[model samples]
Target: MGAGLPADDRARAIIDLVRGQGYQTIEALAAQFGKTTQTIRRDVNLLCDRGLLRRKHGGVELPPEDENLAYPARQVLNIEAKRRIAELVARNVPDNATLFFGIGTTPEQCALALSDHPGLRVMTNNLNVAMALTRNPSCEITIAGGRLRNLDRDVVAAEARDFFSRFSVDIGIYGVGAVAEDGTLLDFGLDEVEMRRSLAQHCRQRFLVLDHSKFGRDATVRGGHITEATAVFTDRPVPPAIAGQLKEAGIRLVVWSDDATHTASSNGRG
Candidate 1:
């Protein structure tokens, strides 16, 4: 007897089978599921729209090759947690102090948190962060000059690094791609890695603003180690293994939860 299945279940099963093989043509999926080509086409389109898979010329595959593919959607995910982290960073900023802001959504939120603060000098490589600070008339904002990277929305050429080197700041707030168990920070591109390193040198104290997802993954390049940072502001508690590593390296981990009353702080010295 043929495999018994409901219509929806059969469609899902076909998708699962094709996805497991990497990518399959429309004809192949339809043949395997014993369905009409039109039905499979509709399923592929629906899955593509929902971001479950990507539609291509021949058939459906995974998402396209783009370094910053999910970046645009990241601002909406875990938004409340990011806001809380941003507020905590803002509270730590001294009034009228010069600060360096790095790229990504977390730093963008930090910029928003500081919007009402007056008389602050802010320098950054991120277009979004610079734009966010523009609404605050009392804040002096400057963008580092460099080749603008469209994908990441930041200036990251050698010129930008040189421009950032010209001034020193009291604090540097940066967003990193990943934080390793051994405390190494990682990012996708070398130019971004270099830019972050330059910003780290120009500031007296460095603060890494990251959310929970960044804790365990490592990207292509290393930006800096966790020990280089004065403090890390994250939305939730880190894994015990990662936390222990940070502590051994002499770094401070500060977690800001949704509850206003609870704050957890720990320190490690390398």
Candidate 2:
């Protein structure tokens, strides 16, 4: 429905994702909205000039202390950083692995990065993930059946838990709404969090991917702690206290900065 959705609705969706995720890149926006890069750029320019968004290196982000942007807007945010995280996630998740892509723009980016890998099975509650992974001919995709959340195109309900109960996944990847001050892994909805916990419990490994914007942001649902993730991939240095907590909890932090990779090049946390 997103691909065939009207221009105005598409733009609004972009704004929702951007606001929620904090960033969106021009190219990613174009792909997600099924528009040309030129068209998306025009929209971004208007939004920026109106003081709604600020330009990033290759994307647009919520300006000032904004809490959330459109989903399409977030698809474009921190494009390079998300791509780097996606690449590493794809590389680490072996071919033929069974994966679960939970809600968030970054998980959709991970689906895009996995377009080439063959012999994979993916289950997701996010419509964006299903659309992105449709390019991979060899990958079998399963979508959870549940009530649709119009703004984000995610499926969540009692049936969603049943959907996860049917599969044993090899890798589970998710995007966070924010990292709460008390070291809680936060998100927006209680249903979404419960669905995520269910999906995560079925996987052998779970990784959390988010850009720097999530830190210090406010979100209502306490999903869990960073320790729930086997590894956390971010685009910048984490707050020292958070990093220490991650290290202490035995969660690996992988930062994808422009200058270098704060990776688990060895088994150690960064």
Candidate 3:
């Protein structure tokens, strides 16, 4: 609700808000931003034209439930939050740990954070993660065999899912396309979801890395839940109900904000 922000910043904020809230009316948006309805309408029109949002009768929602944002846009959106989450996840990793890094920008950022770590073995279907680890001379990277996905720069074919099942790693780091308010994890397609499931099943510890915008967001395919993770890392605290579930499941919640990380296990352990 920072009305002083420039138009582009406001538009991005609007997208995140609508994504978290499902839909927002023009008047509601204007009131939230302390702007006029006419100004909000103009912004909504531009967002609709760009296919980033869908204009309903008197409100805006996400573009399409079946598709995700363009990869480049997703890469830059919530960039700072993703970096902080990634760094904290990396700090928890041991120097010689073996890892399974899954698809998405957040995983790639985690790989980047581990660049200076020694004696690491990484198995990944994400090309970006593999390339990021290549910068570390002491890290060993194994990539899955499949035709690369040009859009996401990762492979999520059936064989890739099978490839993940063959490894029993110390940790699995992954990101989801969206998260339902009830704590269900959603992805764009079955292959991606299956691949993530396989990674979870094979790893000793599962790290779910995501930014706050993913909460209440929509996606086509749903496979896992937040409780499946050993720890959930994000830039903001999750919804109260979901946090309660995490506590019940004894999963660790790691929040990164204001340049500091706060970690607590659901069982009241630090």
Leading candidate by lDDT: 3
Cα misplacement distance, residue 17 of candidate 2 (Å): 20
- Residue 52, model 3, lDDT: 79
Q: Give per-residue lDDT, candidate 3, residue 19.
A: 84
Clashing pairs in model 1, backbone N/Cα/C closer than 3 A: 249-270, 250-268, 250-269, 250-270, 251-268
lDDT per residue for candidate 1 within 170-247, as digits (tens), equals: 999998877777778888889879988998999988888998878776577876787788888888988888777668
Q: Candidate 3 residues 162-238, lDDT tens each?
A: 98888899999999999998999999889989999988999999999999989988898989999989999998888
TM-score of each: 0.75, 0.74, 0.78
Misplaced by over 4 Å in model 2 are 1-67, 257-270
lDDT of each: 0.80, 0.81, 0.88
